[model samples]
Target: MARQDTIDVRELSVHYHGHLALKNINFSVDKGQLIGVIGPNGAGKSTLIKAILGLERSKGEVSLFGSSVKAFRKQISYVPQRNMIDWDFPVRVKDAVLMGRYAHIPWYRLRSSKKDRRKAEEALDKVGMIEFADRQIGELSGGQQQRVFIARALAQDADVFFLDEPFVGIDIKSEEIIVRLLHQLRDSGKTIFVVHHDLSKVEKYFDHLILLNQELIGAGAVKEIYTPEFLKKAYQGSAAVLDDKDGMVVVSQ
Candidate 1:
């Protein structure tokens, strides 16, 4: 059987104070791929994610798993950038991870049951942060903190994931672990969308690519979308894609 589209967006547009932030963007994502949403600074990479998720005001149609976003929100998991979060929230690592289960809890309940705690611990283990479960989130390294966030997402057990710059300010080990877990999630049939900036690791991290610059430039396999022609269009002559032995790398002018 053919794979179904986990994310289907049509003519999605977002504007700010009469300024067009995104224009008639359209794309459909299949299940089980690590898709990189890439573009230059202020290219609306994060805006597109927010628009699709309905966090930002926009005009268009967005459906996840054949259902409207409102009906399927529980099936979606989002992890915003580290800078957007407060590290000094004074929350324990395990407690933070357990927050993912909040939606799963009954509306009448105020606290998590034993199963929720177990799932949270299991998620922490997956990110190799179980040992730091009792530690304050602010005390961990940048990478460790990022891992803890991913663990929280894992506990949600959602079919679709939106990660905004999870690799930023993270260490090599944390990136490696996160990427490995992402691949495993793909293997298990979950679609993951990551807003990434570094061009060097695009191919290494994501097989699928969505090149955006206030609009859709191209969306397809990395080999098809990650080229000089597309990069030029997306960056508007500000970035130069160079030939690298590993693949292609981008250098800003």
Candidate 2:
């Protein structure tokens, strides 16, 4: 039997003012795959994600789990880049996470139910942040904050996860922990898409890749799409692909 597609994008395009950011992009991700979306700055990697999520004005057909994006919006979880969040928001860690449950609650309901709180606690425990649930989000370190956001997504219990630059500025320990958790999610049959910048860890971190440079360069398994030629094309011949002792490729631009 064939695997079911978790995300499908066809003829996706985005425009910022009069400038075209992404043009005619298309890709599909199957269930249980960890997908990396890589490109240089201004390559529209983030734009593509926003377009798929219907967070930006775009022309395309984006479907999640065989349904339209609007129809299944609550089933998807998105973790934006850290810079996009205001650290001084003055919200508690647990409260920040419980925000994920708002979609499940009716608008007439003014508070989260006990079941929602239980789910939030479980998510916090999974990220090892349960002890700090009462602390202010602004008081945590960068890595801890990122983990809290991850827990927020976890609380949503989403089938598809989209994270933008998740590892950027975090410590090695936190990065490792996040990667491990992501793998666990994939193993549990969730589809994960990350906007990643580091190419050195591509082979080790992701099973599939979407190489983008305002257009689709390549999209497939790491062994097939992560070639030196594709890297050069995606980075406009500025990327240096080096082979490590372990036979994995390390890319520098």
Candidate 3:
């Protein structure tokens, strides 16, 4: 028996105005897998995500579930970094989440259908934001705002979810809740790819990892790739590998 690939990225490279960001990257993700991409700042983690979403110009091929980006659009949902969206946009929580359904609705129609509205409310409730439906987007806290965005993505009912820095500024409780929701999504046969910043929690959380540094360094199971040696290379980018405590290696700065 042969297993099919969920995400196939080959020879992927990205350049920003002639500045090379990612170089000759390649990776594959299977269905129902939760992948965590980690690297220091400017290590091209987000660049890979953007390229896959067709948000940036790049040289490579990325196919989701054996389909092109155009065909895979409907099955993929994205939760961008909080900084990318405006908080004071005058949009209510309900209306903002309903935006996910606009792709399915006809442009000629001026309002959301009864079914779409129901789905939107259900999505908000899933993220525990149902009561905040009437509140303005700007009135919520950071974790609440993140949850609303996740709810919007959930309303889309996509098979693949991409999250960028979902745990940037939040308390431990909120982070745990978000992680739990992500696990629930995975159990439902969804694939989640998150750009994570916390290196210490990588082993405690993700099942797989993609470690990068302007190029692919190592990617595989977290237990295998989270070794001290890999961490040293990922964090310091030094060729020398020094052994650290806990039998892990660290390259001194």
Candidate 4:
């Protein structure tokens, strides 16, 4: 039997002030796959994700789990870039994570239930941030903050996860933790999409890849998409491919 598509995007396009950011992009992700969205700077990687999430004005069709994006919005979790978040938000780590449960609870209910608090605590513990639950988000290091954000997303208990530059400015340990969690999530039959910049770790980190350059360059298994040709096309010849004993390493010039 064929695998079901967890995410489907067709003819996706995005424009900002008449400037084409993404054009007629198309891709589909199957269940239990970790997909890396890669491209050069300003190559529409973020735009594509935003369009698929319906967070930006775009022209295309985006479906999640065979349902329209709007209908399945709550089933998806997004972790934006760490730099995009205000460091001085004055929110505690647990409180920040508890925000994820707002969708499941009605606004008329003033307080979260015991189940919600347990879920938030579990998420924090999974990310090794339980001890810092009461700490102010602004007081944490960049890597710690990133982990908290990821915990928040995990607390949502969404089937689909989208992360943008999650490893940026993060410590090696944090990156390792996040990658391990991603693999664990994938093993549990969840679909994960990460907007990543480091080309060197793409092969080791992701099973699938979506190459973008204001359009769809390629989308498939890592072995097929992480080739010299696709790298050159996406990075405009600024990428140099080196073959190693394990696989390939792409270094940007």
Candidate 5:
């Protein structure tokens, strides 16, 4: 297969208070591809994203768009887990979405032009939350709030989007809507990497998979890498697979 180079992380490692989270992780994502990072709890999935964003204390090199992460920050956008934010904060939906444009705005004198407002509104409409444009963020449901954050990321107009646990508390309908929106974004030649929860849907939803367990386990096309054997190894470190004359069988961890 031809190598598709987009975001390259070479020998990357992350540490927090002397505890190693990610170890010698390396992978390259292709442009316009939807990649899903899967792992059991505490397996360093979120830490990997943080390291790439230059937010975590880390080692080794992380290059985005063939340049240093800091230099390429403007081209990337992130949607953090909802629990990471203070939900009670006083901010309207539109204003929250507008925050994504701050990086592109002129410094010192803070102001939003008509173009900014239009873009924010359009993003909200794209996520089916236009009617809730002026609603206070705390007034929305968990799924609606997630969509608002997605709208904000959309407003960024960044080439690469990183979303963390976007499906945790969302309903099936909301999940489908978000997935469709992500596909639309990917079709427009953008890279979207999401930290997903549903294990069964990985093959159906993502083009690439980044399986983690404090270290890289597998990373490739879902159909090729998301096999039952891989899942067994991921969930049960030393577990054995069973087969019989009755037919091939998989033993649970």
Candidate 6:
């Protein structure tokens, strides 16, 4: 079977309070690939995702599953940046994960169905957080909190996943687990876009790269877009020097 493009963006642009954030961006993403949304800070990495997901007001054409994004809401799952989450909210770990299933419920139903509950439980177990399900969300470590949210996405069985900075504020152990889970999702033919920092891990983690800085810098395989020239363009003001022997990006202000 021919592979399908899960996401298609054309002439995409985003502005915040009259400030241009992304300008006339364009790209296509295929399913089953781990694509990194890479750029310097405030580079519209998150905005690009929001624009495509229809979470932000923008001018552009974005299609999911070869159709309007609005038609496929149930198949999409988003794990926003940590700062966006209300950790202070008194929600239990399991309950938080169950929230992802809300979209699947019909408008008439007031509660999740039995199957929804079962899937949520399975997702928690998959992330190794089933035992902690009874605990409060705020009490868990950064990594644990991340895992719980991932479990939320998993329960949804979403086809397209958007994760914003999944690795930030987490210990090494959690990072490793998240990386493995992402790869597993890719292998299972799920498309994922991760807004990532730490250019050092770009080569190791992502199958494809979307290098962005207000506009599209490059979008393709990591080897095609991870060049010094591309990195320099994306990190223009900063000094991004690439070592000749090994592919490591050294960035300094």
lDDT of 5 by residue, 1-253 (tens): 2233578888989987888889999888888899999877788999999998999989988877678878878889999999998888899999999998887888875689888889999999999999998899999998999999999999988999999999988888778889999999999999998997567577678999998888888888877667767766675753344545753343333
In the range 1-253, model 2's lDDT, one tens digit per residue, is 1124667888889989998999899888788999999988889988988998999999988878788878888889999999999989989999999998888999999888999999999999998899999999989989999999999999999998999999999888778889999999999999999999988888889999999999899999989988877888888766676656766455566
Q: TM-score of every model?
A: 0.95, 0.95, 0.92, 0.95, 0.91, 0.95
Model 2 scores what on Cα lDDT? 0.89
The C-alpha local distance difference test score for the whole of candidate 3 amounts to 0.86
lDDT of 3 at 5: 62
Residue-level lDDT tens digits of model 6 in 1-253:
1124667889999989999999999888888999999998888999999998999999989887687889888999999888899998999999999998988889899878899999999999988899999999999999999999999999889999999999999988888888999999999999999999788788889999999989999999999998888888889877667668755656745
The lDDT values for all models are 0.91, 0.89, 0.86, 0.89, 0.85, 0.90
For residues 1-253, could you state the per-residue lDDT of candidate 3 as single tens digits? 1225668888889999899999998888888878999988889999999999999899998888888888889888999999999999989999999998887889899888999999999999888889999999989888899999999999998999999999988667668878888899988889999998776577767888999998888888888888776777777754345555655443333
lDDT by residue (1-253, candidate 4, tens digit) is 1124767888989989989999999887888899999999889888888888899999988878778878877888999998898878889999999998877889799999999999999999999999999999999888899999999999999999999999999898888999999999999998999999889898899999999999899999998999988888889866787777886667785
Of the two candidates 4 and 5, the one with more favorable TM-score, higher being better, is 4
Q: Model 6 clash tally?
A: 0
Report model 4's TM-score to 2 decimal places. Answer: 0.95
Sequence-dependent TM-score of model 1: 0.95
- The digit string of per-residue lDDT tens for model 1 on 34-112 reads 9999999999999999998999999999988778889878888999899998989989999999999988998999779
Runs in model 6 deviating more than 4 A are: 1-4
lDDT winner: 1
Off by over 4 Å in 5: 1-5, 237-253
Clashes of each: 0, 0, 1, 0, 0, 0
